[model samples]
Target: MSRSALKLRSWPLTILYYLLPFAALRPLARVGWRPTSRVAIYKSVPTRLLSRAWGRLNQVELPTWLRKPVYSLYIWTFGVNMKEAAVEDLHQYRNLSEFFRRKLKPQARPVCDSHCVISPADGKILHFGRVKNCEVEQVKGVTYSLESFLGPQTWTENLPISKTSFQDQLVTKEGNELYHCVIYLAPGDYHCFHSPTDWKVFHRRHFPGSLMSVNPGVARWIKELFCYNERVVLTGGWQHGFFSLTAVGATNVGSIRIYFDRDLQTNSPRYSKGSHNDMSYVTNNNQDGIVMRKGEQLGEFNLGSTIVLIFEAPKDFTFNLKAGQKIHFGEAVGSL
Candidate 1:
């Protein structure tokens, strides 16, 4: 589709998304509403089947006429600038999806310094600042608690102290580093996710939920959208603290797959506690931790999606950013 036509098409869909009953949709999600929710007949089967098929097809080598145009459309939709990307040759890609999530040229995004927090991907920074107490500001007059986003066990274990005041200095000396940045990936933006800091990925978890649209408007109107969305959470070990990177899934965005381990596939089943009795068993046994250098590709979100970064308490670093700022891969997000 042409750029103008695509923009025109997105307007009504955007309107419908805002008009929908978001709170009521939460229950349906808890009961298993997902991208495949539309296929009523195959609803009994695992949704992974559909995503697997799509993933396999995306990997199939195809002709340039077919691949290039599809990728061009994706770039146009996401407003991706070819000049900034490492790989600009559209004909070199194997498929539309491959082109959509193409890797950057080595020099395209250079890691700032060993101690710097590098941007995880090439996209626009939705928001970034200190986490005052347990709350994170999504917009003016809108805030969501970090405790609520990370679930009870993880939240309680990670954040033991309560944040009583927002103005009482962002990061205290008590080891709680108050900082987070949310990056939104448009269809044309590079979909690959990278490590923001040098760390060992010790644990990974997938939460099964609905595939709601995560556009800016939807984010403002839909409370707890990021926390409730189907997402893959990756926890990493840093020198003085721990950090998490959440790859949130969106509508028609089949899956979020991490390349940390070759064994983990996008179509794999959700192994959270509620779904399986031995939830910890699976994750613990498969804890073949991998070390990732800053800017190293960790995962990729199929189609387009969002990535949320969480820092442990008493965070020492402060982000040099603001809302709606565009960030490129390998750029310094903050200093330790």
Candidate 2:
């Protein structure tokens, strides 16, 4: 009887609403033009469910004879170098998940100790530089709120935060600056993420959102794409001041496994959107939190994802990386 109710009942409009994005993309596809961020039809598909299903599919063991052919196809498709894997034989991996979580030879990636911070994973650097106006650049020009990304500074009760500005609250010491680095893992890259520096992880925050693709192109098209996806934010302290590492989920990659936190689950069947879960690592052994040395294994993803590092450093800090440059897990990202 109501106008709003009548509109909701209109099947013609409902069909047009859902079909418009696809219809527009038909011509683009025919012309060989591909859009990276499917923003228009993003809500049309159930990406989270697909990712979880993919996670399960990864665990399904294949026939012994089918392993090599199946894995070889993936390796060729993604350009994965089998020589780097500790177990070079494809048969050693029982399932796709095993192959994904395969270990690399110890000597494969040598950590660069000369620098202050090393890359957490082997991927292309999306962006890195100083945080301005409490905002971090998702890509070249796209930005997201720093306060929103890492949540509140409630984990820093010891530090003076009451009277300081929002950005100033994160600076544990004077003359300190905030820096961030975004690393995007491809399907071919190693799945494990490591500690970029010697730090103590005090708290962990999990933000569950859509499981969208986080490749460079999508990041360029979608502002705050990282903020919109499910991400595990590990906040801690280093020699400089505040530090954090965020593991962002992506399409077909919903399972984010933190080696230390077994209780933390991601990409669940049912969850409330726009809500976050938090856990503190403070204990007798970790007065501040879990102590992690540089290059220590932190966690892993089922498939390629993204790692974001935000830390406090001196104004003299400089990045040794170029935007869009490929880097390995132990390579230096920045230094004094």
Q: Which candidate leads the pack in TM-score?
A: 2
* Candidate 2 lDDT by residue in tens digits, 1-336: 678866554443222112222234446556666554346566456778878777788899998999999888677557689999999999889999999998999999999999989999999988999999989998899999888888777875666776456678888888999899999998889999999999999999998888877867667777788888899999889998889999999887889999999989999988888889889899777686889999999999888889999999999999999999999999999899
In model 1, the runs with Cα more than 4 Å from the true position are 1-64, 83-87, 154-175, 262-288, 313-316
Off by over 4 Å in 2: 1-38
Writing each residue's lDDT as its tens digit, candidate 1 over 101-217 gives 767667777777854677888777888877666777555446776755554333213333465543232233465555778888766677788888887666666666556667665
The predictions' CA RMSDs to the true structure, in order, are: 7.4, 9.9
Estimate every model's Cα lDDT from 0 to 1.
0.63, 0.84
**Candidate 1, residue 49: how far the Cα is off, in Å:** 9.9
Using lDDT as the measure, the top candidate is 2
Tell me the number of clashing residue pairs for each predicted model: 9, 0
Estimate the TM-score of every prediction.
Answer: 0.71, 0.88
Error of 1 at 30 (Å): 30
